[model samples]
Target: MLILGAFNLFVGRLYLIPSESMEPTLNGCAGCDGDRIFVNKLAYLGDSSPHPGDVVVFRGPDSWNGSYTSQRSRNDVIRGIQNAASVVGIIAPDENTLVKRVVATGGQTVQCRAGDPGIMVNGKKVDDEFTEKPMSNPVDPATGSQACQGPYFGPVTVPQDNLWVMGDNRTNSLDSRGHMGDELQGTVPVENVVGRVEAIVLPFGRTGFVDNPDIQHN
Candidate 1:
C-alpha cells in the first residue's frame, strides 16, 4: 500500500453497507442490489459545519474505547469484528460511530411524538416525507430497531454544543432519542460529530452525494 501516499485516494476507506438505519436513503448491503458510497473524511476539515440529512461517518464513543482498538482482551478481539460492523451501520453501536441525520443543531428546539409522524422544530411542523415507518431488516442488532413502531418524541432544546440526530428508518434506530444519561440526555457533544455525508459511490445508478428535501417547507 504505497505511492505518494496522499491519503489513499483510489482505495478510499471502503464501507460495506450493513444496516437498514438509513434505508430508502442509503442501502445497507454492500452489494445487496444497491449502491456504494464514499466517505470523504476531509469534507469537514476546514471551518465548516454539517447540515440536515447529510449522511456521515464518525468515530463513535467508549462503546469501543481501549478494548476494541487495543491489543487487550478476548472481548477486544470480538469488539474488533463488531466495531467494523458498527462502522457500516451493521452493528448497533454498543461501541461505534454512527451515520445519521443532523436534525437539530446547536441552538434549535426540536420535538416529536409517537402519534404523529411529523417533527416539530421550534414550534413549527417538519412533516418529512423522507421519514418513514419502522422497516424490518435483520442486518442491525440494536434493540430499538426490533421493538419500535415509531414517530418518536420530546420537546427539548438542542444543547449549547450538542447535536440531535435521528435515523431515516425511524423504527430501527436508537439515536438521540435513546442517547440519554440524566443530564446528558438528548444531546451528543458537538465535537463528537465528525462530518456530513457527501455522496454515494456504489450501486451504479445511485452514485453521488446523498440528497434530501430542504429542512424547511414553503
Candidate 2:
C-alpha cells in the first residue's frame, strides 16, 4: 500500500475530467461528464518536451483559467484539503490547471484557416480525426462577440521551449488560439506541463489508451 501510494504521488497520477472542452476525446462536454484518466507523470522527466498531438495537463497562466469551474467556491480550508487530495490523485486539481493537446512546439508556425478543417503546423495541415469537432476561431463567451469575423488567425510562431495547445472540441475550447495577444502569443512554456495523459482507466466502457494523432511535420 505504501509503495502504491508513493508511486501515485511521484510517478503516475489520476485526474478526473471536469468539462466538455475536450468533448468526445475526453468526455467532459455538456450532458456528459469527463472521464477518469491516468497521467504518466514521468513521461517527460528528463530534458524532453511534449510532442505535437500529445495530450497534456498543465498549469494555466494568469491570463487563462482551467477547462471548467468548480461547482462552488470553497473556503480556504476546503481548498487546501482539495489541493492535498489532488496531489495524490484522489481528485482532479480544480485550480489553475488545464488539459489540452499539443498542436505545435518550439520553432513551428501554427495557424487556423477560416474554412479549413484543422490548423496547420509548420505549413502542414493537420486534420485530426480524433478531434470531436472541426477547428474554428474562438469567440468571447461573455459577450457573444467574435474576435474576428472569420475564424482565421495568423501563422504565429511558437517560441523556444514552448507549446501551442488546443482542445479536441475546438469550437468550445479556449485554447492557445484564444490567447494570441498574450505575452507568449498563447504558447505555453514546456515547464508548466504536468504530464501526458496516457489512458482512460475508469468507466469500463470508455477505458482505453488515448490515441496520439500523427501531427508531425518534417
Candidate 3:
C-alpha cells in the first residue's frame, strides 16, 4: 500500500473526468459519474514536451478561473480528507485542473475559418476526425464542415514553451479559443501541465488507451 501510494505521488495518478468538454473521446458529464483516467507524471520530466494531439491535464491559467468552479467540499473535515486522499491517487485534487488536447505547440500558428475543412496549424490542415460531430452551432454552408461552428478565429502563434489546447467536443469546449483575449493569447504554459493522459482506467466498458495522434502530419 505504501509503495503504491508513493508511486501515485511521484510516478502517476488517477483523475476523474469532470465535464463534457472532451466527449466522444473521453466520457464525462457534469455532476455525474465519469471516466477515470491514468495520468503519467513522468511523460515530460526532462527535455520532452507536450505535442499536438496529446491530451493532457494541466492547471488552467489565472485568466481561466472565472469560467470554472471548484468542486471541493466546504466542510473543513471532508475537504481535508479529500486533500489527503488525492496524494495517493484515491481522488483527484480539488483544483482547477483541466483536460484538453494540444492543437498547436510552441511557435506554431493555429486557426480556423468559416470555410476551412479543419483547423490549420502552420498552414497545414489538421486531421480532426476525433472531434465530436454535429457541433453545437449551425454548420457553415461554405465548407459544410463544423470546424469553426459560426465564428472564425486565430492565426495566433503559440508562445515558446506553451501550448494551444482544445477539447474534442469543439462546439461545447471553452478552451483556448474562448480565451483569445487573455495573456499568452489563451495558450497554456508547458510548465502548467500536470501529466499526459495514458489510458482510461475505470468504467470497464470504456477502458482503453487514449489516442495521441500526430495531428499536424495529417
TM-score of each: 0.67, 0.81, 0.91
Q: Give lDDT tens digits, candidate 3, residues 1-218.
A: 68878898789889999789998899899777799999999999889999898999999899988867767799999989887787777777767899999999998998887666678898889888898876655655664445565357887999999999999988778899889999889999999999999999999989999999998886
lDDT per residue for candidate 1 within 172-206, as digits (tens), equals: 66677765543546566667765556678776787
lDDT of each: 0.60, 0.77, 0.87
Quick one: best TM-score, which candidate?
Answer: 3
Candidate 3 lowest-lDDT run of ten:
142-151
Taking all chains together, the TM-score of candidate 2 against the true structure is: 0.81
lDDT of model 3 at position 55: 98
RMSD of each: 7.1, 4.6, 2.3
Report the CA-based lDDT of candidate 2 relative to the real structure.
0.77
- Displacement of residue 6 (Cα, Å) in model 2 is 3.2
Candidate 3: RMSD over Cα atoms?
2.3
lDDT tens string, model 2, 167-210?
88767777887999899999999988889999998788999999
Candidate 2 backbone collisions, by pair: 19-28, 20-28, 20-29
Better model by lDDT: candidate 1 vs candidate 3 = 3
Better of 2 and 3 by lDDT: 3
Candidate 1 residue runs with Cα over 4 Å from true position: 2-12, 29-35, 63-95, 114-117, 133-152
